[model samples]
Target: MQSTLERASHWLALLCKIVAGIALLALLGVTIADVSTRYLYRLTEGAIALRVIGSVELVSYLMLLSLLAAMAANVEKSQVVVEAFSHGLSPNLKNRLHGVYLLGFAALGLVLFIGLLDSATAAARHGEVTQDLRLPMGPIYYMAAVLSLLLGLRSLIHALLSAVFGAEGEVSHGE
Candidate 1:
């Protein structure tokens, strides 16, 4: 079961990274189109009033999605750790410290996931939407919440294993 879960978790992280990559590419394309259109319109003295409505809103949401989607992969790779004060620890001690750190990260991710869920629910209740495109916000929030939950669960499991086995069964992924 643990092996199965490990495989599942690895696949999940890979999926998240793929989603994040797509989101980043979409964001780049949207930004370039928006800017090019705006510049053309300005250059033509309003002759070409080419404007992508809600481009800003779309970009913001995409940015958030990109971050959220990449989060699980980062957790799996131990890429989110700070490096300001841990230059002196031995490998074993560092492993233990990472376990503790992952536990704290899991708690933080759970809190953020709950907040995202609550905000999604509230948005759904209020029928909230983007100003120009009228795109619904609830679904985006829910997506973020799901990603956060995935990351939190992965972190919790990795932390538990590392705490118990001193990084032998860890999900640090060679970190």
Candidate 2:
């Protein structure tokens, strides 16, 4: 049962990484277009006004999503370690310590997951929309909430593996 959950989490983290990568690419494209448009407008002296409303706002929101989406994969792979005091500890001890840290992350993630859900609900209730595009911010907020939940779940799974099964190899931990 535990292994199944771990496998599922690994797949989810991979999915998140792919999605985040795509979003990052989109962000890059959007940024280029935005800069080019502004530059062209300046060059043409308002003759070629390629102004995109809400472009800045769109990028801001998309960046947030990209970060959120990538967070789970990073956490799952133990790439965000602090390594503050693991120099002298044995491998077993280090792994256990890492596991404890992961549990803390899991707890924090759970809190954030719930908080985002509430925020999403509030945004929906208020019908929050972007200033220029008039795009409802609620759906993205909810999407972020979902991503947060996935990150939290991944953390919890890592914590459990560290605590119960001890530190396994990269393949076992879904490197």
> Which structure among the candidates has the greatest TM-score?
2
lDDT of the candidates, in the order given: 0.79, 0.78
What TM-score does model 1 achieve against the real structure? 0.84
Model 1 lDDT tens row, 13-35: 87889989999999998999999
| Clash pairs detected, candidate 1 | none
Q: Kindly give the stretch of ten consecutive residues in candidate 1 with the minimal lDDT sum.
A: 166-175
What digit string (tens of lDDT, one per residue) describes model 2 on residues 1-175? 6678678877888888987998899889889999999999999999999876778888988898899889877775664555676677777776666677788778877888888889888889999888889898788888888888878888877777776667542326534
How far residue 93's Cα lies from its native spot in candidate 1, in Å, is 2.8
Per model, state how many residue pairs clash.
Answer: 0, 0
Q: State how far residue 148 of model 2 sits from its true place (Å).
A: 0.7
Best by lDDT: 1
